[model samples]
Target chain A: MTRSFVLAGALTLALAATAACGGGEEPAAADGRGPITLTDTQSHEEASRKIIDAWNAAHPDEKVTLDIQPKDADSQRQRLINNAQTKSDAMDVIMLDAVWTAEFAANRWVDELPADMVKADELLAPTLETAKYRGKLYAMPWLTGTGLLYYRKDLVEKPPTTWAEMKETCEEVLPKQEGMSCYAGLLDKYEGLTVSFAEAVQSAGGTVVDDSGTPTLETDAAKAGLNFLVDGLKAGLIPEEGITFKEDEVKNALQSGKVLFARSWASLYGTANASDSPVAGKVDVAPIPGLNGPGSGVLGGANLAISAFSKNKATARDFLAFFTSREQTKTWATINSTPVAHTVLYDDPDLVAKYPYLPSLKEGIIKAKARPVAVKYGDVTAAIQNAVYPALTGETTPDQALSGLQQQLAGLLKQ
Target chain B: MRRGARWFAALMISPTLLVLALVVIYPLLSAARESMYVRGEGLDADGFVIEGERFVGLANYAGLVGERFVNAFANTTVFTLATVALETVLGVAMALVMHGVLRGRGLVRASILIPWAVPTAISGLMWRWVFQADGVANAIIGEKILWTTEGVQAKLAVIIADTWKTAPFVGLLVLAGLQIIPTMVYEAAKVDGASAWQTFWRITLPLVKPALVVAVLFRILDALAMFDLPFVMIGRGKFSVETLSALVWDEATQLRYGPAAAYGIVLVAYIAAIVFVFVRLLGADLLADARSRKGQA
Candidate 1:
C-alpha cells in the first residue's frame, strides 16, 4: 500500500512536471500553514511514524511527513549540513545528534528555538544543555541515551562494581560458561569506540578532551582507563574478536548468551529481554563499571531543530513542540523503551511501571557528559578513534597509544 | 557527406561533454579553488564559522604530513598492490579453466561472475559477518582469529574479500581476451610438440598480456579508491585499512571542505602518477591496441 502510494505520487509528479510550479504555491504559504517535513534518523522509524500520525490527527491542516535519514549519525548530520549549506529548504525539521548541535547552530544552519518553546526546568539538564550553542537554545532535546553494563543476571549474583572486579569475575566465570567470552563492547574503530573509550577514561577519573578543547588523554588515570581495554584483551577476559565488534555485534553476542558481560546503550534492554533473545529474562543492566566505581557515560541523544531555510517555520516549531511534549515523550518511553529528555516522565508512575530502567536511566542522563563540543568534532572523533583503537586491539601499547592520541588530538584541536 | 557526418558527430557528443564538464570537471576545479582557503573558524571554544574567512594557500597540504595521512597512504598503496597482484594471478587462472574444453564451462563462467554482481557495500557486509569470531572464516581455517582487530589480520581480511569479489571481474576480462585468441595458435604449438607449460607461457601468456595489463591498471585505480569494502568490513579510522578515499570522505563529512579538497587533489595526483608509471611500464602497447580498436569501431 505504501509502495502504491509512492508510485501514485511519482506518477502525479511526472504528469504534472510542466505544471509543478503552478500547483506548488498554495501549499508553500509564508505563514507556515502547510505540511512540514520532519527528518529523522531511521533507527526509530516506527515511533517517529506513530508520533507523526498523532500530530497529523491533531492538526489536519498542518500535516507532518516523516523523512527517514540514514541510521548512522554522522551520515545523517552530513546530509542535513549539505542541505543547509546549499540553502535548500527540503527539510523543515531535522533530528540532530547531540554532538552536532554546536556545529550546526554555530553555522546558523538551524534556527534558534523560541525561548518559550523550551521548559529547561522540565527537561534533563545535561541532555537539554546539548541543544544549546553558547547560551541560546537551538534545538529541542528528544531522545537521550547512555551506556549501561549488561550482565547475565542468572550467572552473576551481583554485577561487578569496578573494572578490576569485573575482570576477576570474568576470569572466574569463564570456566563455568562454555563457548562464551567474558565481555564485549563497541570496540570497532568508529564513533562508538570513542563513546566506549570516553566511558572507560571517565571511569578511571580521566577525560579525553575537556570543554576548552584541550587534549587530556595524557594522565595516569587516562592511561589506566585505556589499559582496562588493552589488559582485558591481553588477559583473555575480553575476547580478542571484541575489538571488531560494534553495537549490534555486542548486542547479538550478549543476547545469544555468548558474552557474560557487555556494555551497550539503554535502548538495547528491551531487545535483550525480547522473547526471541536466548538470554531473555536472564540479563540485567547496571551502571558501567569503572576503575573505582560507576563511571561516567558518554551522552548520546537526538535533538530536534528547525532548518534555517525552512519554508514553514511556525508549523515546524509546532510539530517539534508536539513531538517532544511530556505526553508524547512518555508515550515514546513506554512504547520504545527510549529515554526522553523530559524529567517528569522519569518519575511518572505509568512510565516507571512500564520501564523499570527509567530511574537508572535518569541517573545515567544526569551524569552523562557531552562529547567534546567543537566545529571540528568529527575530526576530533576520528583522531581519538585512530589513536586509541590500535591500543584497544593490542596492536599498540597503552603508552604509545596515549601519546599518539595526545599528539594527534593536540594537532586537531589546534586547527 | 563527410563534413556533414563530422558536424552531426560533434553535435551528438556535445551534450555528454557538457554533462561531464558540469559533474566532473566543475567539481574538480572548484575543489582545487577551495583548497586554498580555510574556513572562518579556528579551533576555539565557541566554534563559530563564516564570521571571517582567510586564505591559507597550501597550508592544508602542508598539514597533511601527519602520521594519519602517511598511514592511510601506505595502507592504500599496499592494498592496491596486494589486491591487484592476487586478482591478476587468480583471474588468469580462472580464465584458463573457463577457457578449457569442459562440459560445464558455461556454468563455471556464470558462477564466477556471481560475486562481481553483488554490490560492494553488500559484499563488504557479507565478508564482515564471515570474518566474525564464530563465522565461516574461522570454521574453514580451523582456528579463531579476530580478522579485523590486528593490523595484519584486518588488512589481510580486506585483501581477501577484495580479491574474492573482484577476481571474477578480471577473469571475465581475461576470458574475453582468451576468446579472441584463435585456436590455430594453440593447435600450431601442439603440432610442434610444445609442452603444456611451454604453450601456456610462450603462446597463451603473451597473447593475454594486453588484456591483463589493462585489467591491472584498472584494478590499481579501483583498489586505491576502495572505500566501501574496508569502510564496511573493518570500520573506519583503523590505520590498517583506512584508504585515501576514506580519509577524504572523513574530512568532507566533517565539513573540513578545504582539507577534504586538498586530500582530493592529492589523491588525484597520486592516482595520476601511478597510472602514468603503470602505462609507461606495461600499458603502452595496450593503449595502442585500444586506439586501433576504437578507430575500427
Candidate 2:
C-alpha cells in the first residue's frame, strides 16, 4: 500500500510537471500582445461570439483572439478568484456580473479601462453609481437590466400597473387552474432576492441603501414593500414554492403558462417571446407594479473589465471600446435580442419590431440602479436577501426582518 | 536480501513522498506565505501593499478572533460533531443489514449501495427537490416543508443531503471490517452461552473499533470542509448555516483576497487542530498496530 502510494504520488508529480510546462499557460496573445480568456457559456455564447467575429473583422491586424470557455456563473467567479490568487496571465479581459465590479475593484483584481473609451456618467445613470468605489471607474457597463412584469395579455384584459390589481388577478386565476400560480420574482435567497426586493422597494418608494450608500431599508416604506411580498405568500397568490425559486423557476413559470404574471429581467423577455414559449405572443411586459408610486425595478447586468495581470492591456481596451461603442452595442442588441446599452438600438425599427418594448427596456437601461455601492455591498445585499426571503415566506415578520437588515447593514458598515 | 528489500521499499516510498511534496506541501507552503499579507487594489493584477503584504505575523490571526470567526468556528464544530455522530450510528446499522446474517447477501449489498453509488451532486439535487415545498417528500407527508425558510430546517436539509451521500461510504468501510471479524469468535461466544447483546458488545464492537474510528475521522474531516451540499441546499442566511468553506468561497468570489487569505489560514489552523486532536485520541499507529498484533498473535 505504501509503495503504491509512493508510485501514485510520483506519477501525479510527473503529470503536474508536464501539465505546467506542456500546455498549462498557452500563449494567449492574438496580436503579439497577450491572450484574453473569457467565460461566455450557454445563453451568452452567441453574444460573445458575435463580438469576437466583429472585433476580428474590424481589428484585422490587432487580431484579438478571445478564448470563450463554458462555465456557470459561480464557477466563472471561482475561476476569477483562482486566477487572481495564482496570478495567472492566461486571461486578460473578463466579463463580470455588474455587482461584482465594486467587489473586484475594492480587492484590486481588475483595472479601469482607458478613460477615453467611455464617458463614466454618459453610459448609464444608475450604473455610474455602481461603477465607482471610493471614486474610481473599475468597470465599463456592458448590458443593463430591470425587472418587467411579464403577463399573459390574451388571458388578462390589461397589464397590471398596480400591486392590488395583480394580486386580485392572481387570487382569481390561481385556484381556478392547476399548477397555475402568479410567479413573482424568485423568493430564494440570491441576487434574485435583490431583483424582487427592488421591485417592491421602488414601487413603495423605498431604497435599501441611500445615495451616499448608507443603509436605509429599515424605514417604513421598505417595511411596507416587504409586507406586500409576505402578504402575497400568505394569501397563496404567489405559491409557497417561490421561497426556494431561482431565476430559472420564474422563467419556467411564465414559459409554461402556469403563472399569470411574473416580475423578471428584460433578459428573460427573449425566452418568453421565443416561438417555443407556451404563452409566446400571449405575453407582454411592463415595469413592476406599483401602489404609492410609479413602477420601478432592480437593475442587474454584466460589465466588461481588463484584468490587471494581462500583458495585452492595449488590445483589450480597443476591444472593450468596440464592444460597448454606439455601432457595436446597437448591432449586439439587434442580433442577440437582449437590451442594448447604446440608445441607438431603441429606435432601430428592426429591434423595436422584434421587441416592441425595446423603448421601455432602453429607458430602464438609462435608469438602471444598483442596490448599494458600499464596499460591503455584497454583505449588505446578502442581508437584504436573508431578511426579505423569510418575510416573503411568512417565516419572519416584515418589520422584524427589515429591522434585522438595518442592524446587519449598520454593523457591516461600521466594520 | 533484507537490505536489498529495504532499499526497494524506500525507493518505492520516495516517489509517494515526492508527489505529496509537490501537490500538498507546495500548496500548503504557498498558502502560508500568502496568509501573511495585506494587499490593495487588484489581487490578481498589480496589487500593492496598502497596510502590510509581508510578515504581518499574528495580525491576520488576531482579525479572526472576532464574532464571524467565532461563529464560523462554532458552526463547523457543531456540523462536524453532529454529522459524524449520525453517520456512524446509521452506517453501522446499515452495514449490519447489508452484510446480512442470512441468505441473499449479494442482492442486499447491491441494493443498499444505490444511495451511496449515486453521485453526490446528483444526490444533492435529488434531496433538494424532495425537500422543496411541494416536492416528493412534501407530497407524501402532505405538508410543505419550509426547508430554506427556517434555520433548523435548513441545517436538517444539509445534514440529510450529506448523510444520503456519505453514510453508505461509512457503511461499506464498517462492513469490510465486520467481514474481517473471525466468525469463530462469535461461534465460540455463542457456544459459551453468551447472549446476543453480550456477543455484540464483546466481539463485534472491539474488533471493529479501528475501522469505526477511521470512518468517523474521515467523515469528521470531510464534514468540516463541506461547501457544495449546503451551498446548493440553501443560501447561508444572516443567521448563517454558512460553514468556513462557504465563508472562504463568499469572501474569495466577492474579491476580498487579503481577508480571504487570512480566512484560509484560520481554516487551515482549525483543520490542523482537528487532525491533531483526532490522531491523538485515535492514535496514529492504531490500524498498523492492530494488524501487526494480529499477525504476531
Candidate 3:
C-alpha cells in the first residue's frame, strides 16, 4: 500500500508539471504586435491608466497595459533593478525617479532614445536634464514636482520670503491659534530627508553636490541651510513630530488643521483643496521660504524609459511620446494636480485659469535643482540622509553634520 | 538481509535527500561562496573574473561589522529574547486558562487564535495606525508619545505587535502538551494529598517542559529572522528597529551582493549556534517523544 502511495504521488507531480506548462505563450493580440506593459508607481496609476486607455483606443493594433508598482519609490526602484538584472521581459515601459537615470543608464537597463525623439527645447530645461546620461537621453520626463510652502491663508496675510521671517511669523501666530503647531516638514531618515536637505542647501544659495558629482557641502551656504532646520527644531518653531513626517504625514497635519505652515510637494494642493479637508479653503501656496530670498525647491518627479529587454520597444517609445505630448500632458495635468514638464502647459490659459497657483508653481519648478546624479547615487543619498537627518533631529550641529556628510560622500564615491 | 535493507532505505530516502540538497544545502553553500567575492555597481558582466568579481577573502565579512549592521544585530537579539520570554510566560498562562474547566471554551479558543490567524503584515499595519501620534496609543496614554519616531517607543511598538500576533502559536503548542498528560497522573497526585501548587510544580511543569522548550526554540529562531512585521510597522532606515534580515535586504537593494551574502551567512551561523545551545546544553529534546514511543511500541 505504501509503495502504491509513493507511485501515485510521483505520477501526480508529473501531471501537475505538465499542467503548469499549458499556460505558456499564446497569441494575445489580433494583430501580431503584443501588449506593451508600462510599470509605474501607484501614486499616478489612475492618470497613467487613463492615458494608456486613450492610447490603446487610438491604436488598437498595439495595446498598452498599466502595471502599478509599489507606493514607495525605493521599493519600485529595487523591483525595476531586480527585473533588469535578471533580463526579465516583465516590464516594457518603466517610470524612473529622476535620480535613477544615471544608475539605470550605467547598468544599460534602458534603451537610448532616438535623437529626434528627445525634444529638449519643448520641455523644461531642468526636467529634461534629468532624462539624459552622458549627453544621451535614456528617459522622457513625464511629470514634474517642486516643493511649495503651504500656509493658512486666513491666519497669515502674506507668505514669508525668508527663513527667519517665517520662523518669527510662526512663533507669533502659533500661540494665538489654539491647537495649532508652528510648522510641519518632512525630516524622516529616508529619501524625503535627502530631498529636503538638498532644497534647503539650494535655497541657501549652496549646492550639496555639483553637476560633476563633487561634495560641495563644505561651503557656508550649506552650513546655513542645515542651521536653519536645526535651529527651527531646537527653538520649537517646527514641532518635534516634524522630524518623523513624510509627505503624507505633513499633509495630514495641514489638512487636519494642526499646523500653520507646511512644506510639501505640488500634489498636496488638490488634496488640501478637496471639499472634505478641514482647512480646504483656508490654505494657499507660495514659493518655499529661503535664507536670503525665496527658497529654491528640489526637483521631484518621474521619467518614463523603455526597457532594453522589452520585445516591444517601438510601442513603448511611441507610448512615451504620446503620453508626454502637449495635448495629453495638459489633459493629465488638469485631471491630476501633477505639474507637467512641457513648457507649453505652464503657459496654457486654461490650465492657469483652473489652477491659480500654476504661474508661481512654474517658477518654483524652474528654479528647483535635481538631486545629484551619479552611478553610485544610492550610496551618496544614504550618506547625505544619515548625516542631515541627525542634524535636523538635534543630535548634531549643522557644521558637524555637513563635515560628516562631506567625508562620507567622498568615501562612497571613492568606493 | 541487513545490507539489502540498508540499500532499500537509502533508495527510499533519495528523492527527499535530493530535494533537501537542492532547496536548502545548495543555496547555503552558494551564499557562502558568493560572500567571498565582491561585485561592483552597474554591470551584468558574467563569470567570476569578467564581471569585476574579485576574491576578497574575509573582507566582505568584515564589512558586516559596520555600526548599522551591529546595531541591527543587537536590536534583533534584544527583540528575540524579549518576545520569546514574554510569549513563553503568556503562553503558559493562556494554556492553563484554556485547559481548566470553563464555559464557552470553544469560543475562547477561537477568539484567542484570531490574532494569530491575521496575516503579520496586515496586523503590523493595523498596529502602525493605532500607534500613530494622533491615534489610539496617544489617546489612551494622553501624553502624545511619538510611538514610531522615538527609538525605545518604536522598538516597544514592534514588540507589542509581534507578541500579539505570535503568542497564540506558543499557547497552542503548550495546550497540546497539556492535553497529552494523562488524567490519572493528576488523580494519583490528588490521592497522595499533594497540594495544587505542589502537584503543578512536581507533575505539570516537568511534563510540559519539553513542549515549552521546543516552542521557545522555534519562536526564538523566528523572532530573530523577522522582517516583514517591523518593515511594515516602522518603515526603513531606522537603526532602532532594523533587524539583521532587513539589513541584508537593504544591502541587497543597494547592489552590495557580497556584503548581503555575508550577512546571511553570519545570521545562519548565529541561529545555528543558538539552536545548538538550546538543544544540546539546555536538554530540549525535540525528538524525545518519537524515540521513546517507538521504543515502547
Retained true contacts (fraction), each candidate: 0.42, 0.25, 0.19
lDDT of 2 at A221: 79
Candidate 3 lDDT over residue span B43-99, tens digit each: 333211124678889899896668888898899999999899989988888888888
Higher-TM-score candidate among 1 and 2? 1
- Which residue pairs in model 3 clash with each other? none
In model 1, the runs with Cα more than 4 Å from the true position are A1-31, A164-175, A179-181, A209-220, A393-415, B1-13, B43-47, B51-53, B287-297
Q: What docking grade applies to model 1?
A: incorrect
Cα lDDT of model 3 by residue, A1-415, tens digit = 3464465445545544454355435322221246789898776777778888899998998898788898777878989998887777788889988898878887778878986886788888889888887778889887787899999999999899898888788878887887788888888777888988998889999998886667899999998888888887887777777887888889999988788999998778888988989888899999898998999999888889988778777677778889888888887877777788898788799988888678878889889998887777878888888788778766788889899989888766543
DockQ of each: 0.23, 0.19, 0.24
Residue B43 of model 1: what lDDT?
Answer: 37
Candidate 2 lDDT, tens digit per residue, A1-415?
4555556566666665564455445434333343455544456676667877877776666565556645566677777767765657767778777677766775667886555666754465665555555566776767777777788887778666778888777777667778788755777788778777876776787777777656787787787788778887887777777777777778877787767888777778878878987777888876667776346677677777877667677777767777778776766776676564555556778778877877766665554467665544566777777777667756778888888888888776643
Worst 10 residues of 2 chain B by lDDT: B41-50
For residues B256-284, write the lDDT of model 1, one tens digit per residue.
77888998899999999999999998888
Best by DockQ: 3
Q: Which candidate would rank higher by DockQ, 2 or 3?
A: 3
Q: How would the candidate models be sorted by DockQ, starting from the highest?
A: 3, 1, 2
